[model samples]
Target: MKCFEKLVRDFITSSLPASMNPLQFAYRHNRSTDDAIAHLLHTTLTHLDKGRDLSWSRHTNSLAKKARQCLYHLRRQRDFRLPSKVLQNFYTCTIESILTGNITAWFGNSTKQDRQALQRVVHSADQGQEDCEGPHPSQQ
Candidate 1:
């Protein structure tokens, strides 16, 4: 078994690009005494756990930053007021696209905290739009 593991490691070292770091993840219920089985890489990989869970905080934070920038730019335009429909369209194209990008790939595997953070970003964007438009006729 050790010989096979060594061969596999040697093959990987020879085949993979130098820029890529080789990482080993042990997903065992019981801890193993063998250090080679779960050796840590020199540089830790970001946004991935041993259980293959993705940390989506970076992605969500990027989306929020982009959305905020778009909102600020839209609000700063003083030449003419953008119609509500146009504003909504812009938000959907710029912000919603970022939020939903690759969602199918990661959403199912995301932790509850990650999902809640994403939800907050969407909710805040919605609230910001309402605030920008002022009170609706029905509410007033």
Candidate 2:
């Protein structure tokens, strides 16, 4: 467990359903599109809450940058490894965090497809591949 993972876990779990048992997926390691979306949401929230004086635009942009960077690392590096569950945890939390960081805009809004689309672009660019039919491995 990395420090970033812990921070995300503490922050996201504090507000999410206790029964969600994010840790339970430890053995089922995978890094799918849905996982990424979930991570972005959670991370965006955590970053917004913890990142001092950061505006919504900056927070979202920063997350996007991080997501892109992770994609690049995952594809270009052989040892760029992380537990599937851990990465899934990170991705879901980050996604939720970024979206809801803006309390004013989080009131019953939706961006599932939009976020997935962004992830697709990042994944494709990093892998030099076309659209993935389903969830990705838990490597990136």
Candidate 3:
């Protein structure tokens, strides 16, 4: 858990804005469970884009930060809490590792346009994975 926390924390600290707060965002989705994660990210980004002084700013937390919040939302109560830093560490250590260093290209580019292009590549890479993996024979 410590390693997990460390990786996620680092990722959050660096990937997010230096002056941004992670706990003032909220996300909602028409479909629960499957779309929850993406919804959270979208909401957070939107909140940040709207600035911190928005009326809704006081009522939210970053999706990663919320993982440690009330757990009874969709199911059983969550007994453990993980902070933004820890969550960043976990993501970096786990899924970030899977990026095999491509994440550097995704975020560390010299220009905003370059970064955006890299983001498209990442998106395409993600979509490609779904096609590549397909459905299991058992499901057919």
Candidate 4:
């Protein structure tokens, strides 16, 4: 068993580049073991707190920050008298892309609170745009 373990470790080390630190997490009974698997690089693996419950807060926070920036720029463009269609296209390209890109992979892993927070951010952006235009043409 020890020899087999060594061979597996060796294979892993050989497969990955020297710059990367391969994290070996042993999952049993929906819980990760406390063993220090491998520490080649200085960076530790993220979202290892509760095994199956992968925390997406870091990724979601980054998305939210980016969305906020896009919204700020969109609002600024609106101030400069850009057409509503152009602003909508900008929102679709920039803000929506940030919100929906890679969503399928991480959405399921996100907590309810995290999802709600993201939804709120999106809603706020929509509301902000609507407020600037006094209701969309579709609504009228």
- On TM-score, the leading prediction is 4
Where's the lowest-lDDT run of ten residues in candidate 1?
38-47
Q: Where does the lowest 10-residue lDDT sum fall in candidate 4?
A: 34-43
Candidate 4 local Cα displacement, residue 22, angstroms: 27
lDDT of 3 by residue, 1-140 (tens): 99997787677656665554444342221334435555565576567657553222212222212432212221211113434344345544543344334332223223454344334534543343333345545667
Off by over 4 Å in 4: 1-52, 136-140
* lDDT (Cα atoms) of all candidates against the true structure: 0.62, 0.50, 0.40, 0.73
Clashing pairs in 1: none
What's model 3's TM-score?
Answer: 0.20
> 2-101 in candidate 4: lDDT tens per residue?
9998788677657765554334443222324433422311123343543654578888888888888788888788788788798889989999999999
Residue-by-residue lDDT tens digits, candidate 2, 21-113: 563443233635556566667677667768564334444456566656655544433234544454445444554354345444433233555
Error of 1 at 125 (Å): 2.0
Residues 1-140, model 1: lDDT tens digits: 99998787677657755554323323222434353332422123332465675466776667667766666655543125667677678778877887788675556556677778777767766666677688766789
By TM-score: ranked, best first: 4, 1, 2, 3
Comparison by lDDT, 2 against 4, better one? 4
Pairwise TM-score winner, candidates 2 and 3: 2
Worst 10-residue lDDT window, candidate 2 = 126-135
Q: Model 2, which residues run further than 4 Å from truth?
A: 1-63, 70-81, 103-140
